[model samples]
Target: MKEKAEKNKLLIGIILVLCIVILGGVIYFMKQKDQNPDSAFKPDLDSNAAAMEQGDGEDEPDGIRIPGYPSITIDADTTDVKMNLMNPEGNPCYFTFEIILSDTNETIYTSKMVEPGKAITNVTLKHGLEAGEYPAVIRITTASLEDGSAMNGANVETTLVVQQQ
Candidate 1:
């Protein structure tokens, strides 16, 4: 009985050592990733989108499409809009957004240097728009996470049906 207990104690000790070693390795890797933001290789967004286009000759997304940005919203003379941005991958990304009025091909809003994982709640639009259906487009450009090169761009077309409150 004594010998059996001793063997069990040794086994437990070995397991504890292994656990500690694993924990240390995990911490070390996380630190390394933080220190070297460009260590991971992210596929070029343009290449990926181009490949998809060539595959079936169909339009596909390049950067990760953010949710909650409805294709359409009624401005109703609202002053500001809440735009959101996010970086789905582990790398940081720079974004450029523009709002264009399709009727006149006028760029109503233009914003550059948006960061990752953020919501732009202070976006404002010109009020007193004539009550009617207006077609607008939002163009988004994603730059390289490492070097801020032009990676990919896409457009989100939406219609605003302005009505008096």
Candidate 2:
């Protein structure tokens, strides 16, 4: 009887030790996870914005006159869309308008480079998109210098929700 009791006590001790080990491991892992909450997910707001603004500027035959990003939106039917061109630079500039689809980064429409100070009317979209919400980013770039380098460039981003008709 004494030997049997001793054996039972030893088994219980081993089991307790194992339970403590498992519990400590669990606690340590939980603390580590708490320390790194972003391990599972991360977001790149800047890149996403850039992608949405596919047509940043229009490259003119003479030079590139990119317009600064402004408040732009697309209608649900994927038909009507408008963007206000804002020129932050004190000097007047021109813009080549282009429409890029958010989903596939596709260039749907483009316009001839329009000089600054002259406002452009509604620019139609070329490729019709399916019903879904999307981001419509407008890119503005200036003409490259004689060195064949792009000059002033800026990105203006906005969200567009396209619904079915």
Candidate 3:
């Protein structure tokens, strides 16, 4: 009877240790995830007033409206790209645009958080590319308007055309 009691206590001790280790691991991972910068989109609370003034003329849609960009043009000598990156007034969330080079999987440009009814007309690339056409992706990361939390997003494939200045 004494031996059985000792064995039961030992089993309980092992179970408690396992539970503690599992709980600690879960907590460690949760903290790591929260600390990761790319884990979620952090939104800019202030809306772009200038962009709001330059509205995209269209009736409000039923759902989130993701503007399409089939191509973008830029001057080879300069980093300024002529494109309208907008989040229509109809949308209920914020938008962050990332222009990534397809060939090298490099992000050339990342826009600030854009609110609904606003647009980003002028954008400067990270670096100037040579005069040529390059395949790229416009990765749109959306965030919740109410809480500024990460939300659904979209990727629009486009051709980045660099013209000789």
Give the best candidate by TM-score. Answer: 3
Comparing 2 with 3 on lDDT, the higher-scoring candidate is 3
Q: How do the candidates rank by TM-score, highest first?
A: 3, 1, 2
lDDT of 1 at 141: 76
Model 2 agreement with the true structure over 1-165: per-residue lDDT tens digits: 999999999999999999999999999999999777566423211111111222445543443334444434456555546644433222234344455656677766655544343444455677555666567766555432222234565555655555555
lDDT per residue as tens, model 1, 1-165: 999999999999999999999999999999999778587545333211111111344454664554434554445667565444333333346556677888898887666555554434456665446667888887887776666677666787777667666
What C-alpha lDDT does candidate 3 achieve relative to the native structure?
Answer: 0.83
Mark the 10 consecutive residues where model 2 has the least summed lDDT. Answer: 43-52
Error of 1 at 87 (Å): 5.4
Winning candidate number (lDDT): 3
Q: Which scores higher on TM-score, 1 or 3?
A: 3
Candidate number that wins on lDDT, 1 or 2: 1
Model 1, residue pairs in steric clash: none
Task: Give the Cα RMSD of candidate 3.
Answer: 7.5
Weakest ten-residue segment in model 3 by summed lDDT:
45-54
Question: What ranges in model 1 sit over 4 Å off?
Answer: 1-63, 66-70, 82-92, 126-128
